[model samples]
Target: MITKSDSTTIKSYLEDSSNLHGGHADKVLIPENTAELSSILIECTSKKMPVTISGGGTTTTGSRIPFGGIVVSTEKLNRIISIDKRALSCVVEAGATVDDLQSACGKEGLFYTSHPTEKNAFLGGTIATNASGARSYRYGPTRKAVKRLKMVLATGEIFELRRGEKLFTGRGVSFGLPGGRRIEVALPSYDMPNVKNAAGYFVKDDMDLIDLFIGQEGTLSVITEAELGLELKPPEIRSCFAFFKDEENSWAFAEDLKGKKEWKILSVEYFSENALKLLRRKNPNVPPASRGAIFFEEEGEEGQRYSAADRWLKFIKTRGGSVDDTWVAMNEKDAENFTSFRYAIPEAVNEIVKASGFRKFSTDIAVPGGNFLEMMRFYKDLFRDDGIRNVVFGHIGENHVHANALPVQGAELRRAESICLEFVKKGVSLGGTVSAEHGIGKIKHMYLKEMYGDKGISEMVMVKKALDPGAILGLDNIFPKELLQ
Candidate 1:
């Protein structure tokens, strides 16, 4: 184990991409093995000291930021335990980053389908939040990819759980562990949205016991290792950027693309006029008349690549898209460039928020397919009238779009927060989730309450307390720390 008590050395662990302030920690502890990690937790629990588990530090939710605790980072525990090529699965430690896993799996002609776009993100952190990314349109979220998880409770109890091994019995689950100890938790009764979600605890009728900890945001237990399923890598991927004159054309293109199952679409992403404005800063290739754009990817055999490109060109023309303005990447190098373009939106938004000196406020809301157009219109109406600079982009195939409000002044920042809350309420009313991929960390506690009422929150807290009696893990994640009392 390694420990750093100096404030200067511990400063980097105090913040995440959320840019939340006032975070402080007494020490930073790096444990190399599960036993070392358990011993540290045991001592912290005895002292009633809060312990915040740190991963890649890439989360925008501020989940890893410690308010007052000894930060326990998983960096040194990094390891790829095993890879079963025949079973299409791999087991990795909590500190193994997605980039490392992808490279390892790629050598075996396998792919980590549910990996988030951020390459530096740790596998355990992604599992803790049930993260989903661009390819999630074809392959589901991290919850689906996870086959097993090894977790350590706040009491220093370690246990391994596999999917379908234990199930809920009428909204209750009981887990028997080592040393003759057992933990029972009551599931939250709230019905999760049918759309994409990573909001709060994943709860369902007769849900798998392993799911209880998957999206708990480290509030229940520390995820130590994960056994994840993989997919066969596609032979050829077709990436395209179709520029439209307006939002309606782009929306129609996305909807049409989603309905086509034979197209083998891997992702359907959207970008607004404002988002394109930011991209123009990096790449001046954006057409002036293009107010909106849809970037999509499809996979097929090498022989079918040429035919697929022809079909896509015809479809784009029919959807009011300009072939002259469109950009297509036929090779791997160009495809990666297209991906970087997609990621540039959020990076640009973060830069604006940082320069403005205000905390980031962005919507991760996802609505049902039928209600998506209404939700999109609602966003446009509010954004147009609000007078605050903003940009919209995200996974349109799942009807989950991110609207980032860029406030340069104090008053604008206050109004931006209010407008974001409105987005949350509207999403919930439309039978959507307050958060789709980004889990409710310290920042979105109130939004979680809006989605799940007071009773829903209380039930979730009960589950957390059952696993973490000391209430020392992830103190402010998903809900306020005071609620645990």
Candidate 2:
């Protein structure tokens, strides 16, 4: 019962995201509930119209909007249905923002540890990408946090999937037709890696069936609601920002810090010279002597343990690492300010790219701790030689780095992409992942084969076909469609 005006309004709304890519849908639908969502999908499937589901529209991968057909938005379905305090879990509608859930959990002295950068990103979107952040090194990613999900299949059937159940059968793959008729098909399952994967279908024989929906990016099914695990907040929290003169010193310091069994480091983030310059420009009040900064968080008995900021300075002094400045967040207000500085890089880069009329792309890669420094040295020289001005930063604790390429358009952009692909190939050869935290959306689809060999990718395609025979959901998102075509 979507009117023409309603479609127009929905289309307009979908276009109002931070999406730089300009792929648009012909029609849009806003479903108020799961029933309404199912109905919309039924009609779309009958018409063979492509369908894409969106949450916060913060996806950089062009996963939120398709080239044509209908776009279903779960924005209005946002709600925290219930919190099972005894089980330490919360049930929430798909569109509920991370901040919204965090606020609700804070009321009961609990916390959901999955910390994605965007506060406004929806819970379902986080699940779709298996999103993680600096805290992931300690708390793990969204897959570990999600316990259950209520998802809608391609055939407009609703299925409730739990952590320990099977995923290839039941209501998940079969939909009741008109006059009590039933249609059945096998649901494909991929061999999901046990590590932090946010690329494509996660498949594994002994894996939790619930994980299939955790990072599918709404291709196989649309997640309507989910139950996520929670934990009590740490008793005491403190953060330290340390500045280092060179990458070698920073790596040595991080290794030394890891060796220290006394302190529990929640996150150890690394920033390159370019990233430090951007931070200094954004916050003129902060000194610009820092070539790199590491944010360390710890918890312990008050007054008994050395503060993270104090330890950071001590470590730098002991190692003769030139220390430009240090900042300590002992209180909530200070912590908020420090996090703001860290998160501002993405926004700042986007704005600069827009102003310069150039396209920007981020290359997120993860290498082994032993090879991280070497890889950085290689890429730094590579980009420099290629004349690609960029910024490099990421969660060092997890051995992931976000090498952001600056504004490049048309031929230049294509050239940069080639360079990036070469870099990714090199990373895989060196025992690293092409994608660290960011899922392999349209941007990185070409490199999917390089990361996962032919056998691995063939298994992924088989799963996609089994779950979505029509290929209606987010087509050509993670893996290139030409291969399937």
Per-model clash counts, in order, read 0, 3
| Cα lDDT of model 1 by residue, 1-485, tens digit | 89999988988899888888888999999998899999999999899899999999988999999999789999987898888999999999999999999999989998899858788999989988899999999999999999999988899988899999999997998879886798888888999999998999998899899988887787888899999999898998889999999998999999999999888899999999999989999999899889999999998887565677678889989888867978888778888899999989888888887787778899999999999999999999999999789999999999999999888888787799999999999999999999999999999999999999999999888988898898899998999999988
For model 2, how does the per-residue alpha-carbon lDDT over 1-485 read when each residue is reduced to its tens digit? 34333555666544422244566667667788888888777777777777888888776666675667777777887999998778899999989999999999989878898988788899999999888988887788888898888987776787787777654443244434333545444333333333455666665544556766677876778998999999887766677777777656666676677677677667777778888888888787555555666777776555533445556677767655544566677677777788888888777776766665654467777877777777878778878788876888877777777787774555677766777887888777777777666677766776667877776677677666766666777676777665555
The pairs that clash in candidate 1 are: none
TM per candidate comes to 0.99, 0.90
Model 1 lDDT, full chain set: 0.90
The numbered model that scores best in lDDT is 1
Q: lDDT of each model, Cα atoms only?
A: 0.90, 0.73
* Candidate 2 ranges beyond 4 A from true positions: 1-20, 167-195, 301-308, 321-324, 408-411, 482-485
